[model samples]
Target: MSGPLVSIIIPFYNDGYVNQAVASALAQTYPHIEVIVVDDGSTANQHLLDPYRSRIHYIGKANGGTASALNYGIRMATGEYIAWLSSDDIFYPHKVAGQLGHMLSRGALISSTDFDLIGAHGELLKPQLAVKFASAADFLRALHTFCPINGCTVMMHRSVIGRIGWFDESLRYTQDYDYWLRVILSGIDFHFVNSPLTAYRWHDKSGTSRYLDQVNAEFGIVHGRYVHGLNGLIARIGG
Candidate 1:
C-alpha cells in the first residue's frame, strides 16, 4: 500500500546549516515526502539553498519568528501530515518512515520521537536524549515545569491543526511549548516513539543558548496561560 505524503517543513532563519537540514529532509527513506523550506527573511547563507531549489518548495517571508515561519509553511503544505525540522537540525534517514508508521499503527493524530543531541560540529553529545515518562500522565505532569516535546521531533496530522489551531505568533521563544500545551488541553494525547530519529543541534548560536533570559521569560508567560488547564488535566489523569 502507498503511504501518505508527509510534508517536512523547515523553518529557517539566518542559520548556515540550512543546506544540511534540507538535504536530510530530502533524504528521508519514506518515499512519499515533500520538503518545504520557509526562509524567514534570511539575509545570509540563503545562496546555499540554490542547489536544491528545483527539488524543494521554498518560501520567503518577513522576519517575524519561528512560529510565523512554521505557520506559513504548514499552511502551504499539501501533505496529510506535517513535520517540522529546524534549519540547523537533521532528520535521520528513517525519521519519517518510523514515526509515520508508529502514528498510523496507533491511530494517533500527533506524535513525537526521541532525539539525539549533536554538537556544532555534528558530534554526538548525547544519544536518545529524552526523558522517558512512564505514562501520558507523567508527561502531562512534567509539562507544568518544562516542555518535553521537541518541535522538530514531532509529527501531526492535518486534523490537529483544525482542532488546536496554529502556533501563537506572539510567542517568540516558547511557541512550541505553548502549542504542546494547547494540544494536550484539546484532549489529544501525544503518542511517543522511542526511536531517536532527529538530531537536535546545541550550539552557542542556537536560540536557547543565546537568548536564555528571554526564552525563560516567555516560558513563564506560556506556563501561566496553561498551568490551570493542564493541572486539571493531570488531576483527571490520576496523577
Candidate 2:
C-alpha cells in the first residue's frame, strides 16, 4: 500500500479486450496505483467498462487518436510516475513493481522492458520478443532502424512529460515513436529492463495490423527526423 504512486493509463477505443486490460492493471502486485481509462469515443465497447466504473477513472471524450487520449489521461493523472497500457495489452502482476524498482535502483527517470507477443486469444506467440541490447550504443543504434522500445512496456517519471512534452496529437499512428525520438534527443537515457512484464496482443483489429501502410508512412517521417542525430550519437558511442 506504500510507494510512489504509479498511474497506469489505458487508452480505450472500442477494443473488446479492454476489460482484461483493466483487470490486469488492477491486479498489479504494487498496490499504490491508479488506473485511468480514457474512453476515446468508443461506441461499441464502452458498456464493457461498466463493471470497473467504480474502480477506475473513466473519462469519456470525443473520438481522438491514441496520442490525444493519452495526453488527456496524462493531464488527469495525479501520480508521480506514469505507464501506458494499451487497451488490448496485458500487464503482468509484477509489471509496475519490477519496472519501478529497476528505474529507482538505477536513478532512471524513464525505462522500458522486454515484452511478450500474444495472439488474439492471449496465447503466447513469442516471449521476450523485444531485441535485447548488450550496451547503450546498441540500443541507440537499434532506435535508428526500428522502435525496440514498446510503448506499453515503458514507465517514466511525470517530469519526462514536462521535459519532452506530451505525445504529438498530430501524429495519429506514430505518436509513440515521435515521443521516444524527442526523449532521446533531449539527452535523457532510456533505461532498459531485461524482464518481460507486459504482453502485447497482435490482432488483425489492432491499429498496427489494420493500418500497416499508414504506420509505415508515419514511421518514415518520424524516424527520418531523428536518424541523422541518432547516427551521430551512435557513431560516438560505438567509437
Candidate 3:
C-alpha cells in the first residue's frame, strides 16, 4: 500500500466466495489501499475469514440488506476514493490503478470500467457489454430502459459520496442503479474506461438471480423518480 489511500469495501454474508473477494482486493496492484469487510449477519462460515483477520478491517453487523451494509462501510472508510466488490466477484489486479488513473486524467468524480462475466467456477461467461454515457443526459435517457453502469466496477471520489449522499436503504434490490443515477444527476460527471478491470461472477446464488422479480419491481419504483426529472435535465444540458 504506496499512493493515495483507496478504500476497498467488501460486503458479504455467509458466502464461501468471500475469501476470493478479499484476496482480490489485497492483491491490487495499487500501492495504497485499505480493505474493509462488512459481514452482514452471516450465521456460519465465519471461519473462512479468520486467515485475513490481521489483513482487513472487519465489521459484523446485524442482518440488513446490501444497501445498509454499504452505507456502514462508506461511513467508516478513510480513503480518498472507494471501490466496492461483491462477495462473489473478483477484481482484476489492475482495477484500482487503472480506474484511479482514468478518474484523475478525465477530472471525473466517478468512474467504472468494462468487466468480464464469469461463471460460478470462474469460467468465462461472456465478454463485457460496453457502457458509455456522453453526458448526464445520455445516462438518464438510457435509464428509462436499463441501468448503464455496473456497481462493482465503480471507483468514485470520496467527495462524490458527499455530493450524492449514501445509498437509499429503502431500495433493497436495485440500490446500486438508483445510486449511480443519483450521482450523475447531481451534476458530477461519470466517466468510463474501455478496459475490462473486474470479473463479474454470475452464479445462481448471486442476488440478481435469486431476486429477479424483486429487482424488476424495485427498478420500476426507482426509475420513476427520474422519469419527469430527466426531461428537465436534458433540456438544461441542451440535449
Which candidate gets the maximum lDDT versus the true structure? 1
Q: lDDT of each model, Cα atoms only? A: 0.94, 0.93, 0.88
Candidate 1 per-residue lDDT over residues 85-154, each given as its tens digit: 9999999999999999999998999999999999999999999998899887888888988889998999
lDDT of 3 by residue, 92-143 (tens): 9999999998888888878888999999999998878556666766766888
Q: Global lDDT for candidate 2?
A: 0.93
lDDT for model 1 comes to 0.94
Per model, state how many residue pairs clash. 0, 0, 3
Q: Which is better, 2 or 3, measured by lDDT?
A: 2
TM for candidate 2 is: 0.97
Each prediction's TM-score versus the true structure: 0.98, 0.97, 0.95
Residue 161's lDDT within candidate 1 is 96
Between candidates 1 and 3, the lDDT winner: 1
Clashing pairs in 3: 1-31, 2-31, 2-32
